[model samples]
Target: MLAKPAMAAIWVNQYTGEVMGKYDRPAVFKVASAAHRRLFGKSKAEGAFGAITGKLAIGITTIALLMIIISGLIVWRPSKGHVRNKFKISITKGTYKFLYDFHCVGGAVSALIITVCILTGLNWSFGWYRKLLYSTFGTEVAETTSHKTPAENFPAWDYAYSKLSSEYPDKEIRMYQNEADIVVGGCGNQQATDTYKINPANGEVSSVTTYEDKAESNHIKGWIYSLHVGSWLGWLTKIIYLVCVLIGAVLPITGYYLWIKRLILKKCHSA
Candidate 1:
């Protein structure tokens, strides 16, 4: 597919950290970010390609999955007095029944988590959906702040880095000198915090905003990614999400087997 190579390229860049040239990484990221901006009106922080083909593939897959869940719910509803049976798996009912219960019951249990993944994944691909989410949640998007300083009079990167590093000694800090301001950003052992602005004029830490100070919308946006990847609650939640994803991955294969068996049985019955 057109998008698979791009995905692989991104995966290599992320997990392997291999670059073709001195400026290869940033150049690749810039191209991917431009593609995303053209397609979705925003750039992904990770700089993955989220252009037309990728977005369409994910969007269609998400819709198909939602339809499957809805249809499964309709077909899975139990008779009024036998409601409990719908949730129970009976291995004693033989192989076909066992497979049926595994597919249905496991799917039912994991549906919500899978749905969350789909929705969050779609949000990453669709700008309209993201805008709707922001509006519904009453959250304003954060704007990047830049300050310009005279080229000849700009403070050194070392000075800004030293001042911010000394202030946040316990935290991990990354500093860069822009044309205007020396921007320093850091976080604790966990999530990334806000960017700290330094006055290039006097080498003073001018402003600081932590994660807690961000708007409700921004918080939700951050949490959406965490929840989608099962990182919000640490390793325990990640384990749970992993299991759910595995179950989801296996459902289609099992369902296809069941369908094929049904077709064979119907042919025998007709004969």
Candidate 2:
């Protein structure tokens, strides 16, 4: 993702009706090169490349959606022979059934929430998406990241768990490692929807909490996260998310083969 921006920047600076010598190219590259230097130290090229490729995921996702839409349209439209024949292939019927199912069913199932997630994530990856979702959701969430040094007096996770358990006696603490630099503290009710965050360093409760305090609340969004990640609700949500992801993944593979089977492979077979 960062790599896409860096590469795009490099291309724009180099071409875009601009003229420059090799010396100037290195100088222009230096702008992106500095981000590289910061991330990968002396290995400037790798840093720049990483930034671009990370952001490139959104572009790939967008392209995938476009392909699915086109394939879906082909599946939806009628064949030329249909008008002349009394009985013909329905848009929803055929021998290459999985292909149509892959595009239509898979797409209809995953399109809404996944698209929102992807589009918002693209904004999130770029900083703009956070603002947009936050604004639209009409909630002021603390999206800002914070950090604190581990306490010398206690283990961070143990401290967090003890503190959270004491704070909400009914809640159970679940501490998870979040990347290399951070420890995540989660507290949820034993049989309820409420979740809270705790700061590992000082055992102080953190403000960036996610929970369903009562029935019929913003926890619907919280449930979406649970549904998406398969953590909050139960085995059912997990299985549903896993199956949806699998279906979504298969769409491209099956759709591609379907396209080739109809457009190219079938021709070759007949010939």
Candidate 3:
């Protein structure tokens, strides 16, 4: 619930005079997000324990994951000068050979991409990490936002729609009254959308903010978000990320097989 804002967006066909609306997210998304971020559904803030409420659980998992990646890479490191051997997947050798090679080689490659996703992701899992990013990048921390009611010149539905339609052409725009902004969707990254405030009296739209306009810490954070989700290079990185994620999903099962196999071998030797 911390990061999940359940807001429905309505779409209007200006020319046809038809309204289309639906839930912005799927029903399972709420539970999944809670499980992923907060873990126990406790942290009210994004901060993982504040020392974050709910994030402590995820922070522990994050630390463990970082350790796993580091250890995994060290184990995968080649001995001697046989670097070529490390990259091989021996299909004709045998089933075990093929599985082991795939697990080792695929996992080694997947680890780099997953490591990037994890490090960038940890920025949100802890407060100090975020500050570290700010200081490292020579940027000041962003100020916390507070809600304010929209001004009395609140944009009329038709008035705001007319202006926004042109401003973000072919994009889905949704106006939020309490937040006093129009969120323009489909800017590539989920967090990369642009927001604008409108003055209905004169049909004027003012800049609320856009990801591209962000500077210093916030701008770096946008980069972090893009890198985490693999949107920086558009489709190419996204495709690589997808393949790595799929391989990553298979890693644990392969690891378990190897582990059990080793245990049985040890038992046989002991007997």
Candidate 4:
């Protein structure tokens, strides 16, 4: 369900104003569809795969970009004066230029992915995506049943935090409770309360990053959720994620327009 690669095909076609020959579209869609089936399952594939894949693609691409810039610099150094010299710039300089584009232009064009990631993440913060992911991942996700509230409930967030801390005795707790009916977990070998959430009435300690109590060790989801939501960074972190999401949406739209303009220019020149 990689949307980056999917969008790339669409962009390539649109930029050239030429559809892929029949064989190519089927091949591309086939691979995409298969991946979707594997990751999200047949239900997601048959229904909203396009939208889901498109959104997820943007996020995956955006994350890769941070490293791609560094990798590009390492790989494409032209000062050694190999084939890259035909571009008539030093390897280091050319590599830098290319990386700058890879960072800026590539990020700009793929901002849609970030946008989708943020929005979908926000959506996932709700019960809907949680259920979807749980089912997709084959985790035993229980639906919140309408049970009577016990009059003898402890302070949900505080008690849950204590319980998690006592139970794990290793990982730090963060964001024990938020506006939504969900708990979230976070990073650090040492304890940090900022990355957790606690359910008040039932002592349901759900981590946005983890539905149940994790071990003393951190999981990838725990780390990624911390990084993506900026829970690790404080209020400034949330602000940064918000800003990045807004800017990410801008990048893809602008890139689309830029590509269109270039297409126009190319057509005019040919004419």
Please tell me which predicted candidate would have the highest lDDT against the true structure: 3
What is the C-alpha local distance difference test score of each model? Answer: 0.64, 0.47, 0.69, 0.45
User: For candidate 1, lDDT tens digit of each residue in 48-126?
Assistant: 5335665666677777998998898788877899888888888898888889999999898888889888877777656
Every model: Cα RMSD to truth: 8.0, 15.0, 5.0, 17.9
Q: Tell me, by TM-score, which candidate is best.
A: 3
Ranking by TM-score: 3, 1, 2, 4
Candidate 4 lDDT over 45-161, as tens digits, reads: 244444455546544554465454345345544455464442332336554444444445445444443544544354333446555645554553443322323222325544665
**Candidate 3 CA-lDDT value:** 0.69
- Candidate 3 residue 108 C-alpha distance from true site, Å: 1.1
- lDDT by residue for model 2 over 52-130, one digit each (tens)? 4545554465546756665665555546765333223235676576465556656656555455445533442344554
- lDDT (0-100) at residue 222 of candidate 1? 63
Deviation (Å) of 111 in candidate 4 = 8.3
TM-score of each: 0.67, 0.48, 0.75, 0.33
What is the lDDT ranking, best to worst?
3, 1, 2, 4
Taking the tens digit of each residue's C-alpha lDDT, what string does model 3 give over 1-271?
1143433345555457587554466758766777777774743333443324567767777788789878988998999999999998998987667788988998898998998988887887888987887888888766543233433333464677677777667776655442234333244444454666665565456657775665656556666878898987778889999999899888888888888888998999999
- Measure candidate 4: CA RMSD: 17.9
Residue 254's lDDT within candidate 1 is 83
lDDT of 1 at 57: 62
Candidate 1: residue pairs that collide = 149-180
TM value for model 3: 0.75
